[model samples]
Target: MRFEGKVALVTAAAQGIGAAVARRLADEGASVVVTDLQEDKLGEVAAGIGARALPLRVDVTSRDDVDAAVAAAVERFGRLDVVVNNAGGCIVQSAPEDTTDDDWRAQLDLTLVGASRCIQAALPELVKNRGNVVTISSVNGLAAFGNIEYSAAKAGQIAMTVNYAARYGSLGVRFNVVAPGTIRTPNWDNQPDTLERLSKMYPLGRIGEPEDIAAAVAFLASDDAAWITGHTLPVEGGVLTGPTVLNPALSKKEYPGH
Candidate 1:
């Protein structure tokens, strides 16, 4: 077990990437604390991880909740070695001109400020234990991929990570960002063939799975990446390298091969 005797706290652990990360960490021998606003779903996720997980209800937007959750984690595990800031979402998807002040605020609060609060609350224990942090950013954050508000906030997260690394490296704490590109999750459930369509956007010819992001998080959280800090690792399936061609269906002419 690479993480034997280690303690980890993962925010937004109810489903998707967060759930996968929680399970991966627990499997690697870490006692993990899983937190989310979805109490029932969070409980189920924690239970599925077996006894090594402690489930907590946390509204990351609330400093009180974030602080209490960190306190609970330390009280239960005695120490904290890693904190995964995976709790964020695109609250509203709209064109830049149509986006409202509330939309921008919500996105920033949840995706950016919320992560900051978690990092802040977990800082003391992390500093004391020489812990590390891994934040979940998006490809949109690194590029003009759309989702204006969400993308902006996610970019801010990346900035925050680099700054944290620079400021806390002396304190024995490391920080990194994981930018995922079109990960296949429940969010796309209602859209027909969404995964297949999105797969065309990646050079790998397939969209990423939650485990893909989880693996990256685990690497950055472990000693394997001890020398790595102030880095934004794009876990995207080569999407950031180049642009994909337009959809074949949208083409006016088809090649002779078909």
Candidate 2:
């Protein structure tokens, strides 16, 4: 009941990590506004979470969409206490030589600009509530991944988190980034070797689950993390610890075990 009367807005809440975070927040008594580009899917997610959800079709890339969603949240919930900017996605494949200008721009807009819009729109209310903002960044934000543009944008998110914390820390608003390694979601299931490869990459010997990230978000949103801010936390299964070796199939012959 950490969030007993708090109002939270979570973007990209139709499924995957966003859905998991929204449900977890709602279960702890927050009035959650679930936003996504898919209206029907958003509604279904909200319904499954029970009564404390307001569903909205939102395209985080658009300023109008983000502004309207923030307005809707304030209007419906009376006051906003937390916002989880979880809308970014890696929407395209990249081969450096073949990547188009537009394709690269799209990824930047989705990952960096979209998060900026949410943070800007939610700034006023969060300041008023003395609340928090959590951005769902990627491990690529901290280190590097092969996807050049995507990694750059995610890295921007981490910088934004730090800058926001610096700017708003005095006003009692908190901001942080949660960088998840590979997680077991709908997308992961589709990857041919991601499961095996990711398991090998982590010292924990497994890919992450959605709930793992959700728990971290919930804590950051709550008073439990009142003293914490401006950090890019690696929610990966110890991926940042060192080079890991997968077993039997994908990993090397000898490696540290989880």
Candidate 3:
């Protein structure tokens, strides 16, 4: 029970990585507020996790919704100690020339803008409590992806994480980012072949699981990382550093032994 008696809020926690973070924190004795667009699924996930779980329906893009979710956590539990913003998705892959306004907006909403809302809504409480924030940024933020819009949004998110840390460090509110590579989730459940393909591509010989990312998020949000802040920790199984086709033009000697 690393987080015994602490309170945590996790966004997009109905399923996938968010769900895993919520469940793990609860198992460690933290009272967790789980938010998602799917309220029924949220309840089911919350129930499965036991007494420390409280689920709320949320669309992270909405500031009011984000505020309400954070407030509810304090109202139901005793205080706020940690927050993990894990609501983003890679819903944009089109090139800038081919991308529509909707494509840009949707990806930005989910990745960068949505995270901004949640962080803003959580700040006062976090500052008061001297709590921590773990934002689920992406490897795309570090390296450019073929998807222009998603990459831009994610890069913005990484910047936002740094911004939060910069402004709040004096207040003792820590902020960090966890950028996962290819985590195994329901996203691949529907396409088993796609999952297998991605797994084969990883240098670790397998894709990551929700728990893998959850472990990192929990560590960042916990007191174990008390001295850490304003960093992007990549849990990408070397994807960000390894020999991926993303930049195949580099010489082996230039990028070797990854």
Which number leads on TM-score? 1
- What order do you get sorting by TM-score, best first? 1, 2, 3
Residue-level lDDT for 234 in candidate 1: 96
TM-score of predicted model 1?
0.93
TM-score winner, 2 or 3: 2
lDDT of 2 at 173: 97
Quantify all predictions' global Cα lDDT against the true fold: 0.92, 0.89, 0.86
Displacement of residue 204 (Cα, Å) in model 1 is: 0.5
Which candidate model has the greater TM-score, 1 or 3?
Answer: 1
Q: Residue-wise lDDT of candidate 1 within 57-84, one digit each (tens)?
A: 9999999999999999889989999999
Q: List the residue pairs that clash in candidate 1.
A: none
lDDT of 2 by residue, 16-119 (tens): 99999999999899999999988888989999987789999999889999999899998888999999999888876868788899988899899899998998
Candidate 2 lands at a TM-score of 0.92
